[model samples]
Target: MIDSVKTPRSTYRQEQADATRVRIADAAQRLFARDGYSATAMEGIAREAGVGTRTVYAVFGAKREILSVICERWLERAGARELAREVLDTVDPVERLRRSAGWLTTLYSTDFDVARVLDAAVDEDAETRELLAAKLRGRNRVMDQMISSVEPELSVPLAEAQSMFRAFAAVGVYGALVVDAGWTPARFESWLADALVHQLMSASAVPDPAHP
Candidate 1:
């Protein structure tokens, strides 16, 4: 006869705590989007989250931390890091740039609300601005690497190619097209694919724009 093993009480408690944190973060995300970060009070977050104010403080030390949690969750949903890997793995120069375009569209499409909220709060607080800047730097670093993977095949210099890639990934471009002009995400992706393939790759490599 063998004895059965059971999960530890502390592990269960940690899981419960993590779930509570997520709930608080999600509630805070909605509130922050509706009310600018400075305007959002901790009590409101606790009330919206259905948790005690103390619990909110215990889980997240400050309101900015909640923003950080929300950004982390958004990145997971957007698959930002994972998709960069896909671009690096792609062998064809055209397909790789196209995947990079798709990655940018996915970044904004999955959580444009958060992006808008962050932009709105950027000037509201110093801490918030730095936090957003750090995230932007991290993402841009990955984009640089993805473009570097195809440097040998690029028609332009590496610096020029990277600059073009970063420009296309700008949130402003996406907002102007999809949010303002009401272009669908798919259309933006298609346009970006054509633009990158034509401008970055050699003429021999530029094929008929693959419409997906």
Candidate 2:
């Protein structure tokens, strides 16, 4: 008979620490969204989370670090890693763009407030600006990967492809259409899919505009 391995259980202390971390992060996100990043403080987060300020500081060394954690948590919750894998694994260029649009729509819809808050703060704070710059760089890297994946089917030059990808798949575009213009998430996704296919794909690869 083969022996089965048992999963290790979390200790009480570990569980308590995990709960406190969650509380701090949740409080921070709420405050950041409501008050903007510059106006929110670690002390306020601690008070909102019902923990000591020292505990918040000990768990997250700085306010920026907490913001970083918030971003990470949002990405995880948005299923970004899994979506990236799905996009990469897809071989069809049109399908890849569609998947990418769906992923972006879901991401923006889930964290629009956080993105708005960060954008508002980035202009005023050096640290926030750096963080925003890093995020844009990461987004560009993903776009580069996506462009490379669909290179064989592209009608445009790589630079144009990059530009088209950024413009069509931007979160702000989604926000404008879905949040401001009152389009449904499904409508935004369909429009993005059609727009990307028309802009980047070859004539042969472009799906019927009316069908998307």
Candidate 3:
């Protein structure tokens, strides 16, 4: 007698369900970016993705969960600074400071949807205040690396990098308020570029006592 081997039906169904969840999330992201999160509904996402409304609720539970997923994706892309790391590797302190400050301006500028969603999300959901705090930790880590780029010229101990990082974060906060709050984009970028460059140069101007 020959024995028959069979593939599991549940395995195929699980893969299909996972694909459907991804599609729903992508559709919701596009809508949320176009229309603010409050305006985008589960039915809209279902229609956009060609799935049933039940599918969206089944996968995401609520609209807030979907918004959180989209915001997470947006921040990941906006703060990606690996290119800055490579170029800064060969550059001197002056050039590295310029590049680092310029990169911050880019990150805070309206070029990315995260900048817009950030304000809107916080206003709508109190829970997202914590989400923003978590994202702040990530931004601080990036700023710390930028500070390290200029550490050779810093007058204080390496631990003082935290202050320099905070100054950079202030630049970002002001940049977002000025530009995203309807201030002139050109003037905001120009002013921020000049201010951040000055701050970094001043903070790292003196030679590190620790180094000497």
| Model 2: residues with Cα > 4 Å off, grouped in runs | 1-10, 124-127, 207-212
| 140: Cα error in model 3, Å | 3.2
- Over 4 Å off, model 1: 1-8, 208-212
Distance (Å) between predicted and true CA of 63, model 3? Answer: 3.0
Where is the poorest 10-residue window by lDDT in model 2?
Answer: 116-125
Top candidate on TM-score is 1
Runs off by more than 4 Å, candidate 3: 1-19, 75-81, 84-91, 105-111, 148-194, 203-212
Please list all clashing residue pairs in model 3, or write none if there are none: none
Residue 155, candidate 2: Cα error in Å is 2.0
Candidate 2: C-alpha lDDT: 0.82
The candidates, ranked best first by TM-score, are 1, 2, 3
lDDT of 1 at 53: 98
Better model by lDDT: candidate 1 vs candidate 2? 1
Please give each candidate's TM-score. 0.87, 0.86, 0.60
Question: Which one wins by TM-score: 1 or 3?
Answer: 1
- The positional error of residue 2 in candidate 2, measured at the CA in angstroms, is 23
Q: Give each model's whole-structure lDDT.
A: 0.87, 0.82, 0.67
